[model samples]
Target: MAFDGKLLANLSVLAAVVESGNFARAADALGLTASGVSRAISRMEARLGIRLLHRTTRSITLTDEGERFYAEVRPLLVGIEEAASHAGGASLSVRGRLRVNVDPLFSRHVLAPRLPEFMARHSDLEIELITRDDLGDIIGEGVDVAVRFGFPPSSSLVARQLLETRIITVASPAYLKKHGHPCTPADIASHTCIQFRDSQTRRPFDWEFHKGRKVVPVTTHGPLLVSDAGTLMSVCIAGGGLAQMMAIGVVQDHLARKKLVQVLPDWADERFPLYAFYPSRHHPAAKVRSFIDFCLEILA
Candidate 1:
């Protein structure tokens, strides 16, 4: 067996087969016959002298060797895609299926409303917004980019910090009137506090406060626990309990008529940084670069 470029080509084909689940579906995507696809897989394994797939009539799965090979070649395949896109240069008007994963609240409150402008700017680009509270895997999920909250994972993916968001301790005027305002972190224990427990980190909702130079975490409890910020804000507006909210999420109405009151102004620290993350820079696509620049400009 010679270590030719065919190894890379066959690895790509095998990756497609594994990702698409079956030979027929993989062949459909690759525009190859099912037999051709299967042959490629067989040749690949024979060349490498390893069994890569556990195949049956109805299903197909990767062997341990296949998994390792797939992981190794996955980034290479992505690089090829980026190279092809970059080859088009300015002639390519960002015209591709661009899948993005974003937080549900940000999608609804911020991005969704402003999407028409972006679509109008790039008519050829197809945009699909998958809104979820669950943290999405950009590479694993086949997403072009992901809008993430807080600090990004320490990886090769580029994280462009967009904004320094504000977090505020807030409650409905009614709730505050009934329960009274908490003057200190210790006072939170006496009041019912709304909990956001569905973070990707799976940590309990602990209200963090910054008083002077000291930072403290106040463990409190509420009757309700929520994942969505919009829903949490709704509950707060409806007099649920005191909860900390993103300033953008609560600012408009809170500032206008005061349905919600921002409590403990001095105790609140800055919110986490939001970022637009994508893969490597080896093969940079014009459209992807344009989109990233556009995001930075708009957010800045």
Candidate 2:
């Protein structure tokens, strides 16, 4: 075994490569030539006697060994950088990227509007808010945290209860006036009800109602099926159909402006819990902690 700095360099290069997903891009990011990056990987593989990456013209894929090595070394590199910054007395006012996944409606009407205040408080923090209605694996997706509706899944993740949400049925006044109002759960069967379909569940959610110590599920028919809650709310507002949505999502303007009227007020269930989830709680980063605290303070 000879002394070689190439091993450490290659590890860094490998991280860059994986992060960038291409040799040319990785080289550009690392300020190295593409051939130089390839040579580094080759020499490092020769030194370690292992194939770290599978390369092709179209794409690069990491072998099992490459993945193992990356998982081991990536955190070490991050630690080294953090230690260097710590030794230099880096500012503690929440710096670094905060990757958050949240609902589109929440992101649009709730979080995005108030993000400037958070950004002002954390001047050094760079927040990347990814909006999606679909659920994602936070650990696999490399997200810092996610704001999810309902209870935490049966995963080894840490979750903090942020807010309680109530499901409500809403319909436009014009639609209700033309079609008349439904008095009971059974009335939904004949009316045009907007159905919200979950991608993961692959099924339309039935309108739920409660009656005097009894639970009733109504299977409604509708011409419009929607995945996005924003669109569903819009369709309901435009008199397309009646929809069941979270109170928080539908309450602000409609309840005040009288565009959408809440129906079945006494019948909807109150099982929705908004949660902020992270992969782990063991020595959480300051950025994650600050975001969670903000959500708790503002939303809870």
lDDT tens digits by residue: candidate 2, 165-282 = 7788889999999998888888888999998886567689767786557778888999888988888988899999888888884366887799999887778774567888888877
Tens-digit lDDT track of model 1 for 22-52: 9999999889999999999999889889999
- Per-residue lDDT of 178 in model 1: 91
Q: How far is candidate 2 from the true structure (C-alpha RMSD, Å)?
A: 14.7
lDDT of 2: 0.82
Q: How many pairs of residues collide in each model?
A: 0, 0
Worst 10 residues of 1 by lDDT: 85-94
lDDT of candidate model 1 versus the reference: 0.79
Assess each prediction's global lDDT (C-alpha) against the native: 0.79, 0.82
* Error of model 1, residue 35, in angstroms: 41
